[model samples]
Target chain A: MRIAYIKNKLLTIDESFVFRVKYQTNNSILSTIESEIDTVLSVEHSEVLGALRNNDLENEAIYIFREVAAQFERPVLLFSGGKDSITLVRLAQKAFFPAKIPFPLLHIDTGHNFPETIAFRDKLVKELGVELIVRNVQDSIDQGKVVEESGKYASRNTLQTTTLLDAIEEFKFDACIGGARRDEEKARAKERVFSVRDDFGQWDEKNQRPEVFDMLNGQIELGQNVRVFPISNWTELDVWSYIQKENIEIPSIYFAHKRKIFLRDGFIWSAEDDVVFRAEDEVVEERMVRFRTVGDMSCTAAVLSEADTIEKVVGEIRESKISERGARIDDKRSEAAMEKRKQQGYF
Target chain B: MEVLKIATAGSVDDGKSTLIGRLLYDTKSLTDDKLEAIEKTSKQKGYDYLDFSLVTDGLVAEREQGITIDVAHIYFSTPNKSYIIADTPGHVEYTRNMVTGASTSQAAIILIDARKGVIEQTNRHFFINNLLRIKDVIVAVNKMDLVDFSEARYQEIKSDFEELMGKRDYQDQKITFIPVSALKGDNVVNRSENMTWYKGQTLLEHFEALDKEDVYNVGTPRFPVQYVIRPKTEEFHDFRGFAGKVYGGELSVGDEVVVLPSMTKSRIKEIYFYDKKYQTATRRSSVTITLEDEVNVSRGDMLVKVGDLPTVNKEFTATISWMDSQNLNLGNKYVLQHGVNKVLAKVENIHHKIEPDYSGVDESVNSLAMNDIALVTFRLNKPIFYDTFKEHRTNGSFILIDNQTNNTAGVGFIE
Candidate 1:
């Protein structure tokens, strides 16, 4: 492997192409193809290396992804209307261009989402012309599957797990390609790119097998599903970099804007007219803010920031001391909030 | 900015959560809203000192019980590196959670109470770090004020830990000790005058000194085929691509490669990162590659360079960390997931149970229990391509899922 990389570098410097052939004579399908390559003397295809120093990172990901897409009968792209997922969509499109996305896109709606995020999600799905399956918390509540709690602190963050599981079962999606980045949470940091979920969608954190290198084991029986995160190794900065480079379109709520908000816990709670259970004693006022994360509006709090553009937002986040989830009220509800939700199948 | 994955482990009441909260607070990682929430909750609960545990203990049951139940991933960042700290439960019963947290981290922070010095939890914390082969271990002797800022006590604890270090097999690991108070402003991010006797760097200063090379250099490269993208369109006519993350090493266009299981040989025709092409694909970066020939490669099949062949065997020995309630017995069938491939495996035999307290092995143990770490052997229905966990961390480990419950029951490091 080292020699091949060196040869490629040398070829670039010398501008002289030298192809390496497998020396092994094993009587297998791979050896037969190698012999054919040796007969040709020289092999050629699209060999343009990325300008970025980190080209090697992108190239290997593309290769592994194509391999997994071919093996699964039904694989669904887990679209969350997030920047990371947007990058996955673009990468997936390039993976199989002109053929259209082979799988459907799945979204588990919390019913407490920001209007702008919902609008953008619908627009992207329409433009892509791909199948979109949205499972709702409202449906779950209507069926008495998950009760809707009322009050100023009410949130549907945990209920999304049940809706997501229901959607997977309804579609029989064996593979779910998510946009979850390992850098976001500790539970997520331990997650595999191809994490196995039982029929109930529980993630067994303690017994997770170490995912070495790029080999994603996609072996599971019927009724079992695998959550595939292509950007498992990507950090928040990486996602921001990709968004900036790709010039990807995001919801306006990510940018700075003035809105009627109240300070309940230091976070700016949007005093939107549609929101329910707002205490009269809670004071509401306008504030300059933008959301660091876009989740269920009731649970997702906005940060005070003047960084309207992507560049400034990235710059601000770089120097900021607090974490993205620090403003997330749902997680602030308790210490083990994320772990408890994950045990019950929360993504 | 690069994202750094880290994990924190310690015994119960080591103020692991407090230390984490302090880090976030001192770094200004907490937003104004979060601070207010903490204050309101603290006032409501009638606690004098703000409870940082509330920030990490996300579950109601955990907050009520005043302990962490499982793993909670907390994200914070400096301009240099964005950090994700997996705060795992410290109770002895949740050993599996500690393993889970440390598995993905490049760095680990093991907390030790200065008052109690090194205790049983310290051994478990160090054991998990060594087993996971985490390159960097930060031993933060927290609650320095409780020990009266005693330099002698700090030195004693440090020497005691150095003795325990004798047992670790991975010598490349670097260990650093720092004394700090999580409650008051101390040597976490800022150097402390309280510890005038000590002259080492602060916790954050030490973190700033970490180089990128020390973080990601795990082991050999292993590329497990994720999905195959074949855009057999009219314009391109034929584009057969293999998509996956590059592990261990990089793959370039025109590299001699062998498709595993089938053993079909081919050269990397092209490497694509989105629309652009790349000369090589580095480890951990996800990309697609088209082969020179139209060879058949599918998911679960690996594409590795011929010279660096991993172990392709039907049976092997491994250290099994049992994580479920049901006892692991011989003849039990389980689905063994190794890398991106899975094979039907059965428990062949139990070699012996290694006691958790760094004692001698239990040779006569019949079954393994929850939080039990033991050596065992297995027989696979089909040959699994693997490597010794020490040689290649990515290719050398696997997890066993119980056939009956579909629960991940055991994690195995290939021997």
Candidate 2:
């Protein structure tokens, strides 16, 4: 037996003399051009193969999204116009591709949101053609459901819970999908992927149902709804990496830009919006900064950075010595701030 | 990057939280602000060293009680792999939390205090891991600093644990032992200088060296339809795809498949993961698959390779880990959730209870209480496609939900 090497392609032949004669009769120039084309095809093929390797975080999130659709009749995505919520929207889209996102988005607005975030949220909702429902904390305040806190560190972040619960009751939503990652806060670390809330929307952190394997128990009472966190296993770094890989669009506040800011309690507070309360002695300065997280503008802090692009933002997050929630002033209020807020129905 | 899920189990004061904090701290996974808070809290409490347990005891009640009541998930990553550790408490509903934590994990770490080596809690932890069929297990003998970092002490604990290992029915489990002081950070992320007598790899090194490919048992591919994606748009007017996550094994484009329950046969036309079409959908990848022929498939239906069909049955016996406060008695009815599918099931019989301390099963046991592991038979309202727990983990398990309260009452592994 003999082997014929035909322009980088290997073929076996039994007769060596016949193989040599066949090779001479073949067009060498055409074979060379064909081999060059094969090289290009292989390169493109690997790129596709690379994408075939799905990120576990993305897959699990999408699976949870599908579960929500299958389990509940009235499900809603709790969109905050943040990167995490934006990522959730994309995952929801992917979960049911070619089809529109099966559920509408519910946004519990504090009315103290970054203008850029609101603009971005409206634009995304229009592009995706998904219904957007906005509930205002100001309405809750007006209805005497919640009282506005007035102080130097006062924020409307905690008051959003009342409005959120009201919205849940109004829509009778059985599942509210949100992008609450476990790695964000300690209280969140103990949350189940399909967390069940009572009729009053209270999170029973201590007595959570056991979630075994990939089995999610979405069973609930008539008035109770489950708070579904698809990205419960995802970390901040994973979210940023996924954003960069998918080239997902986020709020402009996430990227570095010239902004008027002030320092308070060792954190940079954006002064571009009048939502954030400032002291009389506080001095404002112009700095290139980006928000590591997007919450109510009153409580969310900015980090000084030059990461204007998604790639640069991811790179900065990888090397940064601070956690994503470190800039969240609301969490800094008390030790169990997140837990306290979550118990009151805050997503 | 690949993700590695792990569960930590030990008795109270076994330093499970400390070990997790040490892993996060040594890997530089903890941010500067978190460290500062830990330091500030530790000093305020008049502790000589920083109390790393504060990092995981998140709930106010847990902090007040100084004991973990619920499982807390901690995340850390090396350059190669990311780790998610479910730190569970070892008291009260120990078995319930341990089972909950270990169910999603590929590996588990059972911590043993060097001074109190291989106690009853250690036995229970090992028993749960064995029952869950977790492949990789690391038995870390913590508080080695208190034991003078004695190799002899470590060996004594290792041999005692080995004795327990002999009693385990699941022999495929791979167990590794390491001596460490999670407080002083020895033999955890870095090699221990105090225990130079032990020449094995550190806990982190051993985990890093593990073959990530064998984490989940690879069985025949089973695609449980989660949702139906029918765009009904102008471009994709007739497009009807069954969206699901492929479990166990890879599913190819042209593979002959049979829809479960209905038993409809069809060939896969295409496998779509988001926008791009793939020739094959690998295990655990959520993809939408279109069949060559339109099949009346809906949620709760499963797609499996022809000739690789699972057992379809309306009644089965399973080992149940009851987690509810109410006693699980025979003749009781509950909602049985198998993956995304739910069916009403009645407790036909209570066979026996297996003690978690390596003792033999109690044949005369009648009912199961909280944290009780027992064998029970259930008759479902409808037949479900299933597999044995030893063969396919995901398909082999189900959760019992209380019909009235909707609480997850128990978790069952099919026999």
Candidate 3:
């Protein structure tokens, strides 16, 4: 044990070089040309279009899903009406395929959610036949656990953390899987796959467990839990492409639709509902707008689009220059708004 | 398209973040909103050039100090492939962060300041890449414009690095050298006009031509059971599938298998990747495997072909990279996690600490501090089936957790 990496005796010849060795030994396995071809075939075996395309991400995601099932006593998926969470449900289904998804679905409904999104969420849950636990921000407000903010720039987005933490405590969920991709925001870029949270659900950004290989450390104490992000590597385009490839159903708000909207601070706000804080001077108008991220109505801003179908939506996403997080008004409050929110355990 | 994960290393002021930002900028990966934000921040900071570091240094303290504090992952793509760059801080204090960044990375870019030539930081960076066994390494000699795009300076640095590369055990690693200025955007995505004497593919070109097969190793198949799917539903009453991801080689439907610890033999009854059944489970594919016999198998139990058994031992020697504030001394107990398996382990003996600069090893050290890399032996409460790190990447590695703090204290590669 008293040594370094170089202290190893040169590796023995017990590796797959055995194929070449077999080729040398009487060539019984193949003809010279075939064996030469066999070596290349053995090296790659024509990777079935890719493990990189979506297969690798899909496989890696499924791996995380199973880890949560095995390592944690109780795990629940944080499903919103967004395409990312919807994709997570599909991955979870495949991870356990033929077997019902082991965990329940938790939606921290801000209560300001779009009517269409809530409808979509219920339908998907019904279709999956999994238990749905809906905890409301309105309930938190009613219970005096949180106070709703006022003013034009205010949103119920930050209040969801209180409800989320409460729900985690109530359910005693040791693992809460979310569809957080690293590409979404700057602070999220440094987050680990199996992110550990304290009893308060606070994230210690300065100190996180180092993840390596395909290994994830799910070890934690009694009061602490892990936030698992299976698709942390997937980009927004990758999500859409996967949805397109798998033909997974999503909330109708993602595609183009006519909606009453108002313009504020270079953002498109849905004027159909009075949930969002809007000034009187802000004139309402009709636009073919689609929601880029399906947060609650108060925070989520729609993107102007004419892409009604999935193919067109995928194409639009590929061509869209602005990031998905750019459309979320909650993030516009400050540069470190997400960091602060995450430190307080906002998923 | 393939996704290439790359790690970047450079000392403070070496422009590692700047190089990553330049890559994203040249690839048109930065959205207009992000660019506008950078412009606004740069203006307020009174900088003539865009402060690209603002894009990656996400934490408040990092921005205040104007230095990267941890590993930040940045995503971009070319027409050929998608790329994820893990930007790691290069200061000696962030050795653990750099090692963590390099562990998941398939390739690494060791940034060398052109004017400074090969420094001590370069040696550590290269040493980390070698320790992690990164298959492909690109030594980008940054800030060539400041040296008047001198080929002589780049060559001098390249030769020095090549000399250091001789000390690594991963002799099969591919190393390429390129000269560029990250701020001026030279040889990162496109060839630099300042260095006409240097004739080679740009840094992007080298990556585009990199095949995924070359980055990952394919070896004998090893499947570590993560969970057992027992669907007692009436539709499949007898259905009991071993859910796990296949590593190394392929596992066919009829392949005879052995469950670890149980030593029970069974034949694969079926292989399912999602709903569809396949004859073979290719390497790295997550699938549900059903055995012909109903032998006892649970999470943490490994399934492999009978002839390809790994080393099952309660005691083993390993190289550990300690990452904790508390010192790791002899007889310290930890929760040793080897793949899906967890076993209580106590340090049997302390070995020599290996310096990342490849200088030498300290044989007399009995304790490991933060960021200390050493070879130590451990005695486990139960035997874990494992492989040499040189043979299998996933099966050969494990992490140590101090039960008191629940902090991942150290990571080890089996010897």
Top lDDT prediction, candidate number = 2
**DockQ of each candidate's interface versus the true one?**
0.19, 0.36, 0.28
Q: Provide the lDDT at A58 for model 3.
A: 88
Instruction: Give the DockQ-based CAPRI class for model 2.
Output: acceptable
Better of 1 and 2 by lDDT: 2
Q: After superposition, which runs of candidate 1 have C-alpha atoms over 4 Å from their true positions? A: A1-47, A50-88, A91-100, A107-119, A126-129, A134-170, A173-241, A256-308, A316-347
What is the per-residue lDDT of model 3 for residues B36-85, given as tens digits with 9 covering 90 to 100? 99999999999999989889999998998989999899998765677899
**lDDT, model 2:** 0.88
B30-147 in candidate 1: lDDT tens per residue? 7665677789889999999998876777555566788887777776666445577888888989888888778878899999999998898899889889988899899999999998
lDDT of 1 at B12: 81
lDDT of 1 by residue, A117-234 (tens): 8899899988887999888989999999988878888888778887889888888988888777765654464566677788788877645543433344565778888888776666
lDDT of 1: 0.76
Model 2 C-alpha lDDT per residue in residues A1-347, reported as the tens digit of each score: 11113412321222223323423543234334435543554455533322245478889999999989988999999999999999999999899998999999999999998889999999999999999999999999999989999988889988988899889989999999999999999999999999999998998887888888898888887999999999999989889877865769998889999999999889999887888898879999999999988899999999999999886787798789998899988888898888988998888
Model 1 misses residue B118 by how many Å?
2.4
Rank list by DockQ: 2, 3, 1
Ranking by TM-score: 2, 3, 1
Ranking by lDDT: 2, 3, 1
Docking quality of model 3: it rates as acceptable
